[model samples]
Target: MKKTSLGIFTVASLAIACQSGNQAGYDASGLDSTALASITEEAYKSYVMKLSSDEFLGRKPFTKGDTLTVNYIQEQFKQLGLSPGNGDSYFQEVPLVEIDTKPVSPTLTFTGANGSLTVKHLDDFVVSSKRLQNDIKINQSELVFVGFGIVAPEFNWNDYANIDVKGKTVVAMVSDPGRYDKSLFKADTMTYYGRWDYKYEEAARQGAAGILLIHETGAASYGWNVVRTGWAGPQLAMVSDDKGASKTEFEGWISQETATKLLNLAGLPKDIQEQAKKTGFKPVPMPVTTTFALKNEFRESKTNNVIAKIEGSKRPDEVIIYTAHWDHLGIGEPVNGDSIYNGAIDNASGVAALFELAKAFKAAKVKPERTIVFIALTSEEEGLLGSEYYTQHPIYPLKKTVANLNIDAFSPLGATKDVSVVGFGQTEIEDYVIKSAAKFNRTVKGERNPTTGGFYRSDHFNFVKNGVPGLFMGSGSDFMEQDSTVINKRKAALGGRYHTVRDEVTEDWSFDGILADIKLFFDIGYTMSMEKSFPNFKPASEFKELGDKRLAK
Candidate 1:
């Protein structure tokens, strides 16, 4: 792919200062209207178009696309007059290992009392191994059905409590019991235990040889195609001291059809899912066994988190962060003769938003009282590896970091009457979000579908996990110019193209929506930067105690 330079654009070159104070027809809450106006549709479109173009090769890390992408962002920060965020360097090195796993035999056969069944790879299932070893094999391992595969002491639930899963293959359901039984867990508000990654971690902790998640569309919040494509290539993970030997031997997913057949073969009831939802449900040892083997090819390399900052005039040590991931799926399985997964919305648009926000801060009439940091993270799609690395090894002190505002995959469907804050009531940052939205006559709301675990699915969750108050906003459903039916059709169409080659910018997209969102984000970050006190997690939030401890001094 040929790389092209979009040229440098400085704060002075924006010429936004000339049209200050309500000239752009937006009366924000006394913020520098000049800075707000600087975030223009032209600039946003240019950045998105350039970053998501075929020339960028989907911006995957450890590839030629990565070199071009990071260099481009560094150049932009330099032109925008922002200083390097990490001790005179715009890049923070993140060591990682990429593993490409291939099955020794493309079929997994399960033998039970009824009969034997064989499933084809990618069609009925998809699997991968995290271990650094070149070969991994599980021979005729006993299969145990562990409901949800979660062990939450606070919830008084343990799926692996009575049974010894050592050296056995455990099959679990995605999501949690609360998703089906309102009486258990958070009741549709998916907890961390509901996430697939958590399930794999718990299985490995319990000494399971292998784990296969039964994929149901609603339970996984995505289709089989997502699993088939997402797990098809090289998987990236942060470099481990033990080289991932501690993780499960292998983790994979089986389609609902395959799972049903497996259950029937074991003479288990068809209503097993309903039974699994009840409390005190025990792990069912299927009278079946299967073999799993994979050959892995891995390499070690270092990717980058592009960081830039604008120092505060007064309290330079205190900081506020704005983050957006820049990496995508790169060239992958071809769809409609196209292999490049140009993640225009998933998140070249987000990186574009990061630059626009940086431009706003730089164009402010007065320097902020707290430093503002912009991070273009890498490898968020590959299980948030970039963020995992950053939070573990922070460039700034975690305690001094006031707040994190994250942008990911902004809608291009024009303006709406409301804006959504993921995990709405968790932190006082919601107060800031509400006040900011009010300035534009927009209402604030929680995520429309909490069962999808949207809160823990992004880069900001890493910050939240470390006791930082993180804000993640979404474009609300109340479209200003369209009815719900019309908007649903458009949204559904967009969802179909998500994480695929067709996610590139199209003719139907409008900048009015994302531009409004960028404005709301600017207000929140700007206000927090000027505040004296740190934001706190709400008492009901799980991270409240962590937040309290961090701010105790």
Candidate 2:
């Protein structure tokens, strides 16, 4: 069961909140609203415009865009008087390789007692592999529907037990089939097993030649266009050790319609779906050869994590990290005439937020007790590559790294009375946020879609996995004393143009929402810096054991 941490500052009650006349209260007493009037809407608008401009080149990884973005971040850190985090250097080099593998024209040679059939790519199947080898192929192999294709002993679900897929391809349901028929599994909430990342990883572990997910828009929460566009672009993989992959050779997704046809060719009843949902279901192979011809060019390049440190007043070695990914999908296939994925909201907002906080601290009358490290990580969208590398090889050890605060895709919804923490119950940092949000009469809420794994999907997961307490929250739509129509106007902008060429800065967006969220983030950082105690995961959190293990030192 999920556990909520004790409300923050409750334990530190007397130590945290200040009296109306106390100097420690963040707000200045007797200060008029006119004092902050100088911090105008124009200032925030101007900042967003520069960060999301087309010259940033969709802020893509391993490109000229990265050159401009990293340089700007480093320069801003310098202006803030933050020293280079990596001994005399701000950059922590992250090597990566871009492998643009074109989906081969699939020759689905289906032979049966009825006749012989051939299927084409897109119309029939799409194949991809991380192998990067030129001769990536899978011919004369069989296709199988493997009941979500998951094997989790904990869930008492193993769709592929007692079966050997040594050299064959497995066609599986995309997401978790349990999503559609909840009674069959977790009931609408997708588990880790349902993710395509997990399904393909299992295929490789099973020694399969290929794996393809059947794409249904509603189930996947993405359209076929997303699959097509993502595959059509240059895909990236991190530079890793020579230890080879137990790679699935021809791996990709097929349309649900095509999957239905393939099942029909195998003389299989479509009702196999319900049977697969039940326990004790096993994978069965259909005699078929899904053929494809994949070709691609590979390029290896290096990227850097821009790191700068604001030294603490006393315990300077211990650090608090504030991070945002400076990389995006980069330049890719265009929708309409626009070719750039400027990444305006996806992260230009995050990068902008980090820099703004750095500036705020620089202007503060007092400094923090622990070092504040501003890290604009590289290749976050590319498998959390940069942050992963940093976690493995830190400028400062994980034990001394106090906490990590990550920002991504700040919605431009007008200010609200609540702030939604992406992974709310994961740590004790929730307490700190709850205490601070109360100042503005804003309540803290949990993620709207835990099934999507947004927390794991972002860079902070790397830190959390390595035992650093982390927090990520955003301004929400619900308002305490605001109009209902006002909330809809903001939510209307949610799905429109996300991750598209359409994601751009405009006058229509009110930065008030972003401004409010950023202010809260600054307060969180300030509170963590001043408090004598270190925040850890609450006992109720799954991650609390990690905090216990570390803090026991």
Candidate 3:
């Protein structure tokens, strides 16, 4: 009788939880395949083909392609009956400073007590800047070669130690020095210090006149052209830093070959970059003077974040957000006779999934207790700008926001028996996913490339940074535990094609995988919306404090 009474009380408690809000739980009867089936491979293929067509002009941040891109998404949101997300408005303006550095000739003249050595561009080095200033010249400033430009206090690692590089040029490693020396930092995986934004911010913090990251193909991931195409445009960032641009300035990345030649002149050992890996590695001031002239132009423009809401029948203010970034490399150099960067798998798949989820929610007649937001963010390709701005300037208080479920680059490669979470173990979000995937006889899995740092590579990082635990998931590589070799090849191949023009629409995709993944994401949103308490990040997650702070409120 005691157990029965407690069980009854718990049931009654759940009933009360439902009464407290209008967010609807999933029908025990479950979802239908009809809508999932409607989200066809052919449809996705067509959308990607159109967007990636040469017409869109490699969807750089502020190109005309952005105009067409945002409008299309806004129209879709309007049709979905989603309410404006950003304060009675769908658009959040992100003001950016675009810096283009076209050095007449980038010359690095490194001098020792003995002699000097000069490095050439492309063959020896490459450089670009983020400071919106025109033509910064460093004629007499000393060049300090810091390993990775990191100052991680948590690790007791300080690349800047006691020597200040203010007004000097920093020739640093592009990625994390920790990556190079695993004994000291998160080896292979990118720490916050590995990010380019971190480098620029650190430089500005030190008052450096310029910062240059030495990029290696292995370290920076993409080639120089990827950096060039994205940087050589009107970039959009928040107007200030507390609100925006406050902490960052004068940033650029140079090739490794360039750094090697300079190191030779500085009398530094070429093979033992490992020396800088240890503690007490002081900043080396090679007698190198670098000079470059940068001239750039910009036309600031407005783009809208596509926002639509399905009001919860009971909890109208609390929300479950479905986010997808809608921009890509617009148009660039032709590859294999094609110049358009149709971001088919890069994100059109993710956006298409966003709509698919919205449609599924609307069709579910069982309305949620919490409002559901469908957001197609802009300028994600330009460095998660739209989502970052949204997190900073939220339409709804994040305290009331249940979760951020992000969709990006849903590869349509045939059906996989499992789903992959980018940050595999960070949250119990995977629990919701596994419970939901069970309906379709699917399984959940961790990303194959945890070493590659896939989790930190998406827009969800913005939400993660803000304390709202976010999830980035995609199709699993294990096709029913299919040959691991095939999985490895396919994963590598798909990763390669992501930012390339080759990623356009194809008849090669099987919608079963896309549908399965979307269903999984939808199930996640539904579960979060129906719960009484917001889902908190796991103990290991860095965002735990954010949730605790909100709960304290």
Strongest candidate by lDDT: 1
* lDDT: worst 10-residue window of model 1: 1-10
lDDT of 2: 0.74
Can you give the TM-score per candidate against the true fold? Answer: 0.94, 0.89, 0.86
Ranking by lDDT: 1, 2, 3
Of candidates 3 and 2, the better by lDDT: 2
Candidates 1 and 3 compared: the better one by lDDT is: 1
Give per-residue lDDT, candidate 2, residue 534: 76
Which numbered prediction scores highest in TM-score against the true structure? 1
Q: What is the C-alpha lDDT profile of model 1 across 70-91, one tens digit per residue? A: 9999999999899999998999
Q: List where candidate 1 sits over 4 angstroms from the true fold.
A: 1-28, 483-489
Candidate 2 ranges beyond 4 A from true positions: 1-15, 19-21, 28-41, 106-126, 176-191, 486-494, 540-542
Global CA lDDT of candidate 1, please?
Answer: 0.88
Model 2 residue 277 lDDT?
Answer: 66
Per-residue alpha-carbon lDDT of candidate 3 for residues 1-553, written as tens digits (9 for 90 to 100): 5335334544543453344334343333254444444455565555666656666665556778777777766677677666676657766666554444555555655566667767665445555555555555556667788876788888788888888787788877766665666676665656667777777788878878777777677677777766655554445555553432343334566666666766777777775356776677878877666555555443445565677788898898898888988888776767788777878777777877776677777776466789998888877876788888888888878888788899988766667877788776576676677656655566666777554466676788887787777889888866753567755665555656757787866544556677778777876787677678777777866667876787567
RMSD of every prediction = 7.3, 3.5, 5.6
Q: Which ten contiguous residues of candidate 2 have the minimum total lDDT? A: 29-38
* Per-residue lDDT of model 2, residues 276-311, tens digit only: 767778887776555556786677888899999888
